[model samples]
Target: MHDAGDAVSLLRDGVVLLGFGLVFVLLFRRLGLGATLGYLVAGAVVGPHVLGLVGDAESKIGVAELGITLLLFIVGLELNPSRLWRMKQEIFGLGLLQVVLCGIAISAVVLFATHSSVAAALALGLPLALSSTAQVLPMLQSAGRMRTPFGERAFSILLFQDLSIVPLITIVAVMSRNPADANGPPGWLLFIYTVLAVGGLIVAGRFILRPLFRIIGNMGEREMFVFAGLFTVIASAAIMEALGLSTALGAFVAGVMLADSPYRHELEADVEPFRSILLGLFFLAIGMMLDLHAIAERPLFVAGMALALIATKALIIFGIGMAFRMPWRGALALGLLLSQGGEFGFVLFAQAQNALLIKPEAASLFGAIITLSMATTPFLMTITRRIRAQPVDSSDREGPVADGANALIVGYGRFGQTVAQMLIAQGIPVTLIDTDIEMIDVASGFGAKVYYGDGTRLDLLRQAGAAEAELIMFCTDGDQLSAELIDGVHESFPKAAIFVRAFDRRSLLKLKDAHVDGVVREVMESAVKMARLAMKSIGIDDSEINRSEEHYRARDKERLKAQYETGDLRAARDRIITQDARPDTGLGGGGK
Candidate 1:
């Protein structure tokens, strides 16, 4: 039986994670590295194999799994099926070929070096077939590359990796020692099982989960909702495992099915904390699994192998990216981002150990190598940033210029595209300024007068016709830049009507304070539609509903002003939404 002191020690273990996490975050910031790398390095320090600060906890694996689940779930939320179909050439065509070529090439090299069977070589190769979706996406998002062409290409590749894992793992499972590896489950039987599991999941995910969630939501219990989220993951995983498939694959499929659900955001919000904690725990467990004692004794061998792994993978990716017509800097970033082995490699290695396909010592060595590779990513990204910031040739800046039209759209992102296309269809003269080179090319192909330039710079805006323009629309995501553009426009072109898209009420208030003529709330538009629907259902005339909505909108403006002054508009927004739902609430009664 465990002693009371053991219980106390266990209680203290959680505290150590907090202390280590903070020091790591601060030190990484001081070192000019991102906080994510710090968190990973901190896990290494606190792991049982390192400083012995905290021993491995099996429950932490669940935490890490949760992290991956939430990470992929959020990714699914961002993806639009229509957008994916449009990018199928790069995603399926280019991406599929890259995975096949890379996997085969890497497997051959690894098999030759290790004298491993084809199964073992293929298992090892599969890990490198995937790039780090988590690392790449966040880096692109931070560098404002998420809206760029390179970003879209990277996303397509990442999506392919996500989908490929299912087939790759299935192959691995088949190749690895089943009691009858020569005569495994019949192909037809396996196919039928996979089909049935996937179909049932889709049916349940669509019809059953929605009604279940709606019932739970009506109960208004936050904890219950969180429980339901967990239930979904566990239940899906169980069904998949019963059919001899991966739990990760099951979780991913469940997420894809729920991607269009209204409750997705709520589900994500509810699950994120659990996911983060688990992923951290997963990293910590990885740290504990590393054989640091062996590394200390064989530092030269470990270092050499790490260098070779990184160098070879980098060269392959860089070469392929260049061949695909990626600009030098973009190729450099892609190569660096993918140079390392990922957590998935560790997962595959562990499975190989269970199958007795790889020696335990060999698995340990591979695991350490995989961990080291993941740890090196942030360092590489930091270096890549420096490379990107280097001076470029003037001749390389060749691109078509935006026409000096009466109206200028300073951004060509999703929201900007919608507004721009509508205006163009009406024959209103418009020019677009966007920093994304790919977006500029795409928009120009569709007959838009678009140029690549940093819109935040007033000089660029002036050159793009902001001064002579009848109107300037700010539809970008950058809060500070959008606000700055509004201020800049007021100073330079006081006669031009400045319209800006607001991410939320706070931003709208900020724009209003800047005396902007028009501000569109992203969520407010959706909320108004919902309000109109509810009112119509309750026997309110369409004309009266429109008037009521307008009155509420005016009331909301005043309320937002007060809330903004108080600097707690989130709470105020909630209150306002609640009040808007009540018939007796004192905003207004009828049509405009």
Candidate 2:
């Protein structure tokens, strides 16, 4: 371990990996290609097969495995039981269908070509069935589609795939077990043991985990808390390995158990850096493992196999989407998004090779094909976006909202829709204006009164009768656009009362400066409501909770106004703190 040559090699590998990774990531991003592809290219260039800068890709396997575990752990942290239940249809219905159908179809092809045993065919095909969650989710998020219908469907399918890995690992382990060893446990016994191990994990998570976290949290040492979180993940994984189950399953369960904890956010922040770096290393390892020699020998065969895999997956996914009644455009986009083989394929294939489920030669060829397919995903997604793009219709000039509406709503997005719905239910007439023509079209289809026009444009505002409206509400997502609208309306139509939706404290303060009649911080009220629930959970009385909330809200409002007026944030904060500390103050008690 202390050898100088070993240290030198390690240093050299690190240097080449990080150096090439940085350059490739920046370059690929500028060229509109994704980072995962960049990592692969970087690894390929500096690998032993190419430049010999980094020796023995196998040496990094253990580190790469940890990256996969951490990635699943983070995924589990983002999901809770309730959220899982909400998407049960997509997860169980569409997700299960996709895996089964794709696996069967691919396995049939593999069997026909190689005449392999069913188990071996399945071992190869199942991995191919899974799509890249790591790549697809981030791409959707960056494109502002994470909350769209297509994005939600893609996420549900991905979540199911992630969960499906546990069972796949168990199957591989079972298949790998030697039948000749009579001393080894029987199949039935092994199955019972697996069930027992899972039950034990559930019990431990429910009874033991929360209290342990509570004790750690009370210490007030952030580093200690971080250590505890890491320890929980690693130790859980170790226990699962000891019990002959997958480490990933254990990590996922532990993450879900802590998902509802107050410390969830802190734990996420603590583990994110480790997860990112390790995940990068995992991708790098895959790149280094690329068999350039195999590719060079049969480039045509490899290219054809890659294309077939993509086309097969894309066609199956598109068919599934159509069956589920998704719009053709959305279905096509989803197909392209999920056509690539997942990062999990590498892990599964390696495990299969070790288990003798497939020959090493076949595994190498398949691995190369998977890597090539992954590299094509970003480009395919760009094409899918083009196909899904909608043209704006500007021919409709009729006022969908009543011509004499009392309220003018800027931006008919999610927030604006909710506000408009509540007002409409109460018989309040509202005229909506938004820059997104697609959103306007969708809203109009739902019988909403929406106009396709930019709120920041004074000409459009006048056309929408903003001057005659009793109140102009700014519910647009963009702070700059909302600010511009606020200033324009205040200057041009002084009689119109202005209300705004602000994303954060800065936006709130800026809106106050613009002299809006009302400003609602996006999450402030919801946060207070959550705080009330927390207080109630801790046995605080209902009346006490209400009184405390009211007093705190009033004081906070006064303090915010003072902070804005005097422009002395520190002094204002200090005064509020001092006042709240006084026993005579109503805020210091449940009630006067």
Candidate 3:
């Protein structure tokens, strides 16, 4: 407890965490488990109860709290209201349905099993209604479901859960009956505090933070922008606390208001390093706090509680998914996805313990249960993989009628639009096949010849005259699927020339692997166009133009390869630009 001893204890804690984190990272890589799961496991190992290295586990919870705030800020940056409003039915109706139904069902089960009061049951159930956005979204993106119907449904539910935590906290605070003066404030007062805190933060973010960010953006200083983002988080959290509301709510509100701000993406990119480290520390603190001894001592009781918790929550989520007419497999997937208690559970559980909604022993039991359930979710997902492996059965539309079209555009994305427009201007009859309804709708409004169907769907492609078209363009983005389409088009229509769009170098390699007639890197094409314009501005002429372009492309590809290999993009960019600008360098004999 002495000053020197405290310093040594802190150093030991850091050492414990460093060792634990590295081991978990290696294990996670081998297991193909995500880094977040690895972080949690690392926290558990080095936590106070396991090794006593963290020493007084509760102390670091504050830093973990800040990490959650930063996470919410980043999440807020992802949600733009105009875009959100476009999915109002899903966000409002289905989202609210998922939260309320899940909460009520789980609360009822808990009440019956524990003989707890309705209010106490509600307090426990509210947290279970939330799914882990951090854990789920990245996986969904990796699965290529970010824009899919199922992904949108999952996203809406997660967003609602985040918003609902505010009300849940207030309700628990008001309903608890224990200590004489436990009636901290009136419900109306809490409501007032919540509204003022949220509204004021939004106003500040818009009028103040937005302008400040614009000024900092003009400075073009990455470090300064990072500092400004941190300032926003801390300031919002402080304001929320001052107003007797949750700091998480304030941070989220700040994020939502800045969702459409010009510099939102820039702020996110700059703030990432800080957010990442803080979040890692947070997970480490969580691990260090775990009382594994307690879990072992009451193994049967804790195991029973954890099982009951997951079962109750899963059943509720599954039933809701079914009622929404989600396929059986999708329902099972949804059930498993939300079986664990999320981050908000910690907040509410702590509050409930303080408010005497349950005894300290019960709170400890709940905490252990939450941790166990979370730890098991990844394995549960793996077990249900077979159920999710079934192919989606969307009804196929007859592709564009085999017509007088000589050229065919297979995708209607940014690259496809440019290609289609230019072809149309040149009086080429181009038929478009795209699966996106929104894109098809927009194209229809502009009187563009577009088919509303998946290009990769063989029937649709054949019906669209793939066998007869003079030219076939595989401008779609998926890797294997796009390659399949190219192969199918080539096999079915041997005479048609194939032009494909490559998403990245790997995709370019895949296209080359498939031996597509011509492949263009969609993003690099834009960069090359800009480079050509710059070269022209500098009085570069026809004799040197092709050589200069080729040199830039080769240098750019090398730089990208180096960046990917080393995970140090800034250094690679610097090397590329420095090498390119040198006059002594030969651009393959083009006046270098």
Task: Mark the regions of model 3 whose C-alpha exceeds 4 Å error after superposition.
Answer: 1-5, 29-33, 75-79, 176-183, 193-224, 256-260, 297-315, 318-332, 375-524, 536-547, 550-592
TM-score of each: 0.68, 0.75, 0.75
lDDT of 2 by residue, 1-592 (tens): 5699888878888988999999998897777566777787888888867887886778786777787787777777877768888888998988998888887787776677668898898888888889887778878888887876677899989988988887887777677733432345766887887678667777787788778878878888888887988887888788878765678888887788778777778888888888888888877887887778877888887787778888988999999999999878778888888998887888788778767788766777778888789889888877666577654545554433338888888878888988888988999888888777556666778887677766777777777787788888889895664456578788987878988888777676666557678888887888899989999998888988888787777778788878788766553664353444543455334233
Per-residue lDDT of candidate 1, residues 254-343 (tens digit): 777777777788888887887766666665555566667766776665555566667777777777788888878777777777776665
- Model 3's C-alpha root-mean-square deviation from the true structure amounts to 6.4
Judging by lDDT, tell me the better candidate of 1 and 2: 2
Return the clash pairs for model 3, or none.
Answer: 43-287, 44-287, 47-288, 48-288
lDDT of 2 at 523: 79
Local accuracy of candidate 3 as per-residue lDDT tens digits, 408-488: 888998789999989989998888888765466567788876787767766776788877788888788656544565777
**How accurate locally is residue 116 in candidate 2, as Cα lDDT from 0 to 100?**
83
How well does candidate 1 score on lDDT at residue 417?
90
lDDT of model 2 at residue 44? 83
